[model samples]
Target chain A: MTTSTPLQPVVQARGLVKRYGRVTALDHADFDLMPGEILAVIGDNGAGKTTLIKALTGAITPDQGEIRLDGKPVRFTSPMQAREAGIETVYQNLALSPALSIADNMFLGREIEKTGVLGSLFRMLDRAQMRKEARAALTRLGLMTIQNIDQPVETLSGGQRQGVAIARAATFGRHVVIMDEPTAALGVKESRRVLDLILDVKKSGLPVVLISHNMPHVFEIADRIHIHRLGRRHAVVRPSDVTMSDAVAIMTGAMEPPAQAA
Target chain B: MSTDQPSSAPRGPQAFEKVLPENEAPVRFEAERESGIKRFQNLLHSHPTAIPGIVLVASLVFFSVMVGGRFLHPFNFSLIVQQVMIIGIVGIAQTLVVLTAGIDLSVGAIMVLSSMVMGRLAVEMGVPTPLAIAAGIGIAALCGFANGVLVTRFRLPPFIVTLGTWNIFFALNLWYSASETIRAQDIEASAPLLIFFGQAVELFGARLTYGSIAMLAMVAIAWYVLNRTAWGRHVHAVGDDIESARLAGIRTDRVLLMVYVVAGVICGIAAWALIGRIGSASPQAGQTANLDSITAVVIGGTSLFGGRGSIVGTLLGALIVGVFRNGLALSGVNVLWQEFAVGVLIIVAVAIDQWLRRTSR
Candidate 1:
């Protein structure tokens, strides 16, 4: 058997432990996400995949863990700190304002202001410039079906809203884009569009962390699957080696873990 | 492309196809046909000032036709402006609170209380006129900050907080003013600055007060801030969906607190206008100002639900009330009937707002 030497993980977690009173959410969990690869994390209910992501994204500080980004140990105490470090998370609820236009929603917190007196003296937003950039971002993602960039988000269909959310994450994300349930709330066609957008994100040179329950989707897109069980990494297996049932069985703890972790 | 399958290593191209999705299909869908009413709703929703603007014009036409040349005269038009000046100023403050999905029922009390402080400090306590005025406006802003704190820190609903503070401020006004109206002559003698806004400028047969012109300027400044600035967008975003705003990194509590403080400052200015308009500082003054201001905001097409509406619409709304009352009275309508007409307009305006809001869903 020929084995290729693997590059160091872009984001790595080791010995993560979190306790909520008497409950142990994460017990010495270890995680690895290699550079430029789609990594899928699958687990059953109460298996602590969320806790693991929270620890990695700085939403919560684990009681014990060392997180490394690009081989440098870092500590983040807030989501903003994580975001500043080139990690953008597309939350499941999307966090979009319905009454605001697409451009306004896209530039909600970090708005582009006009230059000179209009911007500094009057504190005016550069609406035209923001609209232009918003259009460019949408076009880059091939999301041109939305003709009016000024239309309110409530006017959009479910799939379109998801598309905008992904486009937002893609535009700002520098190194890693983490999506929690990107396709869980979508219809069949909407899910398909989301899957394509995910690949587009990867193709644009950003690694993606997809957390989902869709087995076929996991097998189809993920280069490697991280099966989590009992608050720790059970095994890392190549998608080409594990069958869907075997992945599910290992996740649910009905089968032994693979001998060789990918 | 790298493949993990050792057995399927020879099937290189097909192996890549197994993991990667097929070429994405172009997003295919046509725009849905919208009914005319829906389109109109969209138009009105985008430009909230249109309906109230139309209503103001329609009211003018209806009154002029019903009452002839007297109603259309510039003098009569100025009378309408003078009548609505207090409500117009107070309504600006109310519009700010309402735009945040909150209602300030204590605005009338705040204005009256601030005026009493201005009058008592200048005329009775012998403070400099400018200092008294500054103190009054400052006190009003402090009162507003208190409301903001109680709402944001305690996590209380604004309606409940303002409703409680309204009674507190009203009681405070009664105590501080000794339930007595400051006579206009004492203010005229001691502090002419107290009534500065009441001074009139005659132009083209129309007598316009400094207060009325100030109200106009205030409206313009407010419109610029709400439409042109980042803070204004955050205000809308916070009101529209607070959770989303917070997730987007807006400090929602601070935004909400600032909104209340700004509303209070506007109220203080309204108090100055009130003192000038009525020629006295009476705890009894502005008894109906709260409801009247609310009436103007609603009639102007600013949504009670917040995250929508404009100050221009609010100006038109205050005018609508003024014209309706003056026009109805000129046409010999009974006072009770004029009140009834205003009540009907309020209901209709709210109904239209509710209808307009439905298009978003």
Candidate 2:
């Protein structure tokens, strides 16, 4: 479904190369994420999905690649640099301390402090500001039933945790949000809620990169699908151009055999 | 809206009447057993580091009771308080390092070196007593700085770093003093600082020593710094999971460095408390102080794994050890038996600490 005007892509990467010892993890992969479009990266286990995300998010450095944020070349040495450059990633492990409260996890390292001697001497955290903003962010994602922002994350269910993570990623108004299997472990209802949250994120005018192996769920939400086979991005297909059967055939490599003869 | 409401009225009551939880009794019963076993398993796993403190206390109590309660007297209580003051104060510094999953084994030697710095300043260099005190603290800070840099910058394990410094300071102590004891009247005219130990407040047939108050104050400050401040949070975070804390943008190395420096400064304070109590300073003084303080810290509830513990527990541990020793001496249990008792106490305390750690998790 192409619009009258072409949307400017938020993230563009080309010829990404990564090697571990002798085995290549990602080899010459290319990807483009347009603004307001949900792009899905589908692959089997150890199919370079994790490596590609890590490289794009600057968690790991690739030997050869150019990542542009809105067409400007940039390099990130640390996750902090990537965060500042507006690339937020919510990993499968979720990286949130269970003992800490939801608000505390949201602002764990980047706490807002009052400027004064007490602030320096006592390191007084601005708890009120963080709570208010965290609540607003959760509410924007339609998670209003979670009235207690100070509750420890350990008490939350899996879907609630994912919701909090998505809220954290989008609350910063990041240019690109990468979610690793946001609904993989969730049940049907929870998965539906997560999909709706992803839609909300896209509607807020930000691009999303979703990595999952669930084809039906991917078909339900993604506008464009990229399949990785043997450490390379084999193809990018629009959901409208291909049926579920064709997509599965392409993924399983049963279709388009002997294209080398052409 | 009315059509929808009318359709749901009969069905809503029927749905409410169909109670389901009562039918799932077996599932609920299994869930209870599973959580119960999990909680029990958690309780059984304790840390080895906290055992020393408990044995110190329990044995001390057993000895005091068996020794005809000689440890319960007011005079003997004051003596025990005075005896533990130096060790307790130095233990505060040790506590800071241990909280960061690190240790400063050189604390005993640092005390000796600081005394030498003060001895040289006042006795050899002809400086005022106050200036000498400041110089002692400065020397302690510098020594701490060296320890901090070596450990943090080089990424060396703290145990090895502090062990190396312990010997270094021991050598420095002998080189500076030349095996001579710095007497009280050498430079400072007032013997009151030295005699402060003998002087006790007599109130209604009981007297309390000033050294006990100073020790208590030091404990209070240590407790506050470890529990209350932002610096304390950083210490726990760094100790708990350094990489995660760093990813959160916490300056972990700097926090570790400051912890060591603060520990060193506290050592200097302990040196003064030692000098005030004994009225003399020598290179050989505080030789066993490190072991005593470490034992006391272990007996306290603080885990060596870092990120969990309290200063109050440490102080209680110190008092327990002190009381036991004083009680044994007053009741004539012999020094040989007293040492044996202390050794046994260390083992028991460590065992309990391990148990507590397991239970908490």
Candidate 3:
């Protein structure tokens, strides 16, 4: 949680602005993520937390802003471009084909083909290899509760589906992972599992940007908290430096941000 | 403020085991212990063709009992095969589109129009039979391409797009053919190759036409493509959730376009089969084929909702229709009643689909 060391920011945004008609969604917002740190972005409803995340993930473009990844300026016009730039996002909906098998869902857009002539000529998928790899990836994440890799995703519980989405992001994400409301719909036990998953992802040495509403969950996992208020970043504080009530009060405009942290 | 525990304090396998163990084993066993009807519904959801296979067998037995041994006669069985071949072939095209949660109401029109192209090219233009056939299939593919473009680029619903195209293709068929019917005698005498499928092969005391065999072959190929290839998986993925597929970086528009184009080519092949079955290329034939092919797809256990269906199930669906018609005919049932029976089958199929979907959720 120390800011004394000069570690480079993996992803940095400045002067990010977006507007819908007269109402501004984001106004000169600034963000920073240190290497391998879990940065939790939190705010009340319509505080433009989603807008800021969307801008960063290339879901939407900001009117005026500069985003730098690894100190190099970048502009992403679409989600695909962001993905190609090594940014993976797990959406709240999970973005999975429910009727397809778990293995198929895992390999989805980036499928592996057969090695030799079969792949080149016929474009046949190596089903066995994909299944094995999918199982391995889930097991590595300690998500082996799923007994059958061939079962359709709809048959799985909410937690398992969330796990699958995270596993997908973890497998392909090279630089950074972004999760939008990862445990919003889950019960107590499921939320715990997802929290554990977020920690596991951070341990893999990839920085995670988690957008969540739960203060306790954020307090439990996040290294640093990015407080968003009134369509802009209000404060950036370490979890150890702020209590849950203070964070909530700062977000709700009940108390001013501590001068030192600001 | 109390300091929060380190995020990595509860890491690795032991932590996951503590969180996921309570309900996993119970849920699996509960699924296994469900009632017979629930299990049956589960089967229908997972393997859509199971009910169709059972229905086919049950109908065969029912017809055998109603008509005695005559229903099982080789001649009668082959007759049923011939009756189902046109719809069955077209059903392959329908199944492809349907797998992506699409419908091509113009499939029958495309088939008839393509056959007309083959007939006019061979007879009036004096083109060789093979070349004429190729022209017919090529035009069909182009028509399909147009449909795909309209659906994808214009963002039109498949139902509306195909419905409009159906009328357009039918009108084109009539205009191009000038309401002229190619005579069977001329086709047989001048271009015997066109009528080649009419030739019969005897196997195990039953007569099977090449046209019927072609239908089976198309089914097998469709099965292989849908089940074995990356493109096939893409079709399923697109049908299941287009938004998810797009997010996953699949070019959903391209997959949908390919599906439409492939469906059109298959329809053209059906056109060739149509010429072989009837010994002539008539724009008037297969008038009810559009509905018939859809009927076959639904009965075969392909979900109208898309993303979950099999081509083999479509073949069985087509056969189910054929069996019902022939069996009713043998029992001296009215023709109108036969149509009524098919209507009932469609509703039941959809009902089964809904029931199975409920269990999956």
Candidate 4:
């Protein structure tokens, strides 16, 4: 509905295909993530939404596809490469080591080494700096309920753990943040807090690609809804132009996608 | 109302006045203050080595009291240090492996085999002593690399892989050494350096062996590496949660491989220490060392479940075992009873570890 003029996309994938044994997980799916917008991906069970996201995030390689970031073709062989390309993913399981302290978890893969010879020779981590920055990042994201950055992640509540995971992504995510069902395991209050955090992330001027099954949450925050069905993108609609039932109907193939959204 | 009193009269409806009675704040459940016992449990859980340290001290005191202060002598104390040095050294390798949530049952086998290499090469083949020692260490590292490859590339469970290797290495040791025990006289004559750690120095009227000093230095270095290095953190992360570590972009396979290799190298060093302690390279030596090192690690507060342990705790653990055995012997306890006590100590140590873990949860 807001498409008064065509806008360039931040990320685009074309003709993506993946097969697992005899099952076609993704069947030539095409997708787009516009710049500075919340793009919601909704699909039914076995609809291949996860495969598409995995392919996009370099968690898995597609059988055939052309992916462009900033209009430049890029291929990531691993999640680490994707991260280096400024694509950070907050997985549904939260990917945080329970035994590690919050600050340690925040800087898990990308640890800050101390300056000078000690760091180079001994690979010594700058624990104090990491702790300080972890605290500041959490505070900036309004995650002040966590009193101790040194406390192990297992000690935190579900909401607080999710907050830490989001804080980590926000801190390091230079270009785009991708979340896979961030609020799926949270209670009502916690989900609301996470929703607020997503909005906060959006306000900071980063594009987000959110994958969720919750219709209301998607409609409430999404600028554009991508309905996945039969292992492909079935429809892409503005949230304002489609009802929840209409989106569901198109996802389950009860109705065809509206012509304007095709 | 009088005009003069109009100003004092209440407004038609004061903004501050409550429209309805304010509801009492919703009842919230605050966690109750921890009791003394709970607090103690928390402390023990946070510092797993504390219980073992206490047990070690208590055993020392008990032995002193029972033996009428004989066990408190500097001579006996230094002897205990000497007796525990082999196990202490081997426990370093075990501690590194266990930190990655892996068990190296072949550590004793590796040490024995490596020492055999040192003995045969130096004595039978007439190779230089230093080169033989280096080759022995290199062979141990090679075996470790095999274990790492099997565990990482083949995706085999470390326990099964190491258990298999344990038998393989033992068989190799028997075959290679031809089941012959190198005599102490021959070792001292041909390869004097092999028995170098057997030399002792008088420290404050107590005899301290080079073997014991080497063991302590090894533990100190392990402590520094595990606590202060990035590689150490990687090992912990891999053990704590392999999937999470992988997702964090850590090369979990590489970490596991390095852990195995480093553990092998440490076991090789322990082999050198073993030669010094025994003054001979015998295929039969370190028979019980596998289980003994595990006991030390468990008692030292390093979790067999992995990712949470300390080298200092392991050192203290080895010392506790020594004190128990020495104390029991001095107190006229039968050898059978000493073995039985160690068994009980192992069970108690593991139980304490489990209980501490529960408190943290």
Candidate 5:
């Protein structure tokens, strides 16, 4: 029943396992990310979605299994390691500093320095260059309405802030962008803008791994969907192959099918 | 992307938009409803974070008026300057520690210990005045270094570590002096040159004392270090968010140690000024400096939470308290009530600061 042929998977995980205290968050879960495609990971609360993502992103350690990035076997010891290997994860919290402006937050730890000892002596930041680059990123994301790039992020709306965060991940030039329920605390208009941003990101030839519990959203944007049940990825189906009802049954662990499908 | 769909409302993850009404408010957007000038004013006025500075300035003005104009008289003004130099110097030292959201309760005790050591070495040990003075300050620096080590290496809370050092210095000071005052006679033979800080420098229609000039210079340097330097930025970052600073690869533990050590060195300078101005080094001298220095810091608009403060604001705060006491003393107010008056002023200053903060926000 699958219409389109499967694509090349950029990220492939095998036999990943993790246990926290008495609870087994992830057990032998395997997942895959196709090249230049959006893969949605959806499950109920505490269904090990975050755990799996964290393990993949090097935020947490896994007990077993191997993860392959671009067909290369690698283990990320820290978030920096993952980021260096071209993996960027935008958490639900976004990890943006409210006290600093958008441009400052974008280059928080890494700042562009001007040339010479005079620059070192004066400790002057290259405001002109940073502003120019930040403006370009904002324009690319259709967020030109934000006039002052120097104002604190606390002053921005939810959607605008999320847009800034997505812009940051994309600007960092990471090959894989993992968003952990990015639109969870955003409004309708803002969430839509974010989805558009996702499309724009995909157009840039980067693959996206979006984690969420929203089935309609998954069906709308995701090229392929992966559902995790009881510590294993139970299914990976393309949107065109199954109806919304079929996807829900797979998510809810109901084996029964509707008479129409037969 | 599917059709470049431009419906009135954008759609995405339904979990966010359909649920969680809290996220849909978009209150941040309304901040732009005000004009540019109004927003600038709002930013200044509502910065509750700057309340301590406001109270410091207002208290200075109120106290200046309360003393029947004697507060602003050239001679009385110079007196205020000379009187608060010790507190001002120590206040700057305390600022560094407090900026990291840590406190050094040993400031007063350290000042006393440093001065006692300087006096004894110059008097009893026959050391040259300069050498004796250096030794005194060196003693303070060492105390600070120990405090730093305890806090950073041992991972002790700054409060407990500094409090422990405070008692140790107090005991040392009392034991060294045997509860007696080290008189000017003994000090004169040793560090006579250091006594120049007690003298006054005459200017146009007024005079600025040596200690006051030194105090002002220290304030300027401290302000620059806290506001302009790369170290300053890192200090503020560590104070504001330790975890974020660590992730950014800042040596926060080293920075904390440096802050404490710098504070100790300032206390050494303060000891020299204190002994010069008072003409003696008694174990009991500078007993109230610790509390007074903290008061200045709190009144200077520095957040107790760290990551925000100004040395200029702190100097102004110090001057305010100094002028209030000088004015009250000149107006024939009972000397017994001076402490009470200062206490009342702190509460009033802090209250006004809080009001301004709440209203601005």
Candidate 6:
């Protein structure tokens, strides 16, 4: 499907099995992401798209699976651990504290401490340094229109908030960035900004996993399309190989998925 | 993309444009020039502490103009500090809890329990004075930590957890103290340290007790912790939006537990101040302390819903209550009228809070 496919996948998940009593969410899902590609995961409702992504991002642990990061087997128990391994997620709800300032929310849990007794003894934060770094991160993402680093997230528009959330993920996601419905709640113009941000992030050389319901957005941006069906990854296809109607048919079990590498 | 025509909005995800209701779309675009009042609202909303600060200064000015020199005198101000010391101390605890979007209805009960522990242990059991006090504070912390455990581990709502513990801690206090008061003289004879906070130094025309000074210091320290530290920011984050805080990788349960435990420690200290202020350890005292602290926190511009407030604003809130009581009494207003005034202030403060919150959309 591509002129030159890379030998190594940036993130690889194999034999991922998750269950909740009688219902199985992710059933033996296998996935792969080549370097510097926007991999869009798409499926009909209840087709285990969310479960597969959650299992990958440490939002949920699989009953059975092997996940590899940079060719080393790894298991994650929490989002924090996943982040520690250089995986960042931008949740659908834009997981930013509304009342906290932009810098505070950016460095919410991993706040920088001052160098001396003010930090060691009294636990004072280095607000100036944090603000400077936050400004730099935003600038790196071409989001410097936000004039105030101390402005609370509540004060920002929906597009600006999404910008902040994506900026956060892009700034920290060294290995891969996984986003769940990042544009699900935004307006048309705001969604445009987010799609541009996804491209901008990819340009910085990190792979992206976009979980999207919008077919148009998918066909426009995704380098590889991972079709999930019946609780597992059905096929990994390129947009150039099929029409949108055939993809929908495969997604809903109306047609057989084309044989391809996943 | 496909060589075919690009899918337009009508062909994109069906749910995308459905959520674009006109009424709620303004959050995406609110850049128009604001009216005069809108500008003022924006100013007040940005600085959560300014409303209470202005109210305090205005009230002081009003009371001084009405009650003349006596209301503004240094001695009168010191008396106000003394009057609010216990509530002020507990108010600090209440602020911590309220900032986390929780309330401790058991703060008064916890304070009494700790004081009664000190009183009963030192006087009846003949425990060492310092040891008894330590035991009391420790028990107080245990009670607070218990509340934390129940709230976090059990995943119970904080209001309900504290409501149940309020009664549990109150019953424990009655059982420990036998529903009796330790006479001031008996405590004086056995443990002078119990009343150490009651001792005062004369400054000009004022008598500032150690408890009052400690209350002030506690305000300063709490302010420093809340404003200058990462833990403090996490507290705001968890309160502002716990789910977001968790998603952001903060140990939210741990933060909440710390909040409850620290609140418990403050209650223990307030118990010490309670003994000094009342000159006796009485189980019947502080029946209204829990509500009173809530009053201070609310009036201080801290939201009951959590994630927005200031510690210094709470101290000012306590002073606001103290000033109203002293000034109204001095003006020959009946005790009933004083309470009436406080009730009005509470409603107004809550109304203002609701107003400020509604504008965020």
Model 2 lDDT tens row, B225-293: 654455665676676557656655567889999988998998988777777677777778999887888
Per-residue lDDT over B1-361 for candidate 6, one digit per residue giving the tens place of the 0 to 100 score: 3434323322333355455566555754665657788888989999888988898898899899889998878899899999988889999999999999999999999999999999989988999989989988999999999999999999999999999999999999999899999999999999989999999999999999999999999999999898889999999989999999999999999999999999999999888888899889999899898899999999999999999998888888988998898889999889999899899989999999999999985
Query: lDDT per residue, candidate 5, B1-361, as tens digits?
Result: 2322222122344544455556645655665577776655456543533554565566567767776566666777777778778888999988888778788899999999998988778777788878888999999999999999998899898889988999999999999878888788867766686576887878764578788999999988786666445566567666666665544445688888898888899999999888888988788899999889888877676656666566766777687778667766777788877778778767765565555434332
Docking class of 2: incorrect
Clash count in backbone of candidate 3: 0
Q: Write the per-residue lDDT of candidate 3 for residues A1-262, one digit (tens) a residue.
A: 4668998899999999999999999999999999998999999999999999999888899999899999999999888888889999999988899999999999888889999998998788899999999999899899998989999999898999999999999989989999999989997677888888898999999999999997777877888889999899999877767777788889999998888862
lDDT of 5 at A12: 90
The candidate with the higher DockQ, 3 or 4, is: 3
lDDT of 3 by residue, B88-177 (tens): 999999999998988999999999999999999998788999999999999999999999999999999999999999999999999999
lDDT of 4 by residue, A25-131 (tens): 99999999887888999999999999999988899999898889888898988899889998989999888888788998999888888899989987888999999
What overall lDDT goes with each candidate model? 0.87, 0.75, 0.90, 0.87, 0.76, 0.89
Q: Where is the poorest 10-residue window by lDDT in model 4 chain B?
A: B1-10
> Could you arrange the candidates by DockQ from highest to lowest?
6, 1, 3, 4, 5, 2
TM-score of each: 0.91, 0.76, 0.93, 0.93, 0.78, 0.94
Instruction: For model 1, state the Cα shift of residue A11 in Å.
Output: 2.6
Q: After superposition, how far is residue A50 of candidate 6 from its true place, in Å?
A: 0.7
Q: Candidate 4, residues B1-361: lDDT per residue as tens digits?
A: 1222211322222232232234212212224555889889877766667888899888887788888667888989999999999899989999999988899899999999999999999988999999999999998898899899999999999899999999999999999999999999999899999988889999887899999899999998888787667777788888888888888888899999988998888888888888989988999999888889999999898888888888988999999999989988998889999889889988988888888777665
**In candidate 1, which residue pairs get closer than 3 Å at backbone N, Cα or C atoms, i.e. clash?**
none
Q: TM-score of chain A for each candidate?
A: 0.96, 0.93, 0.97, 0.97, 0.91, 0.96
Q: Provide the lowest-lDDT 10-residue window in model 1 chain B.
A: B5-14
How many Å off is the CA of A134 in candidate 5?
A: 3.9
Against the native chain B, each candidate's TM-score is 0.92, 0.82, 0.92, 0.91, 0.84, 0.92
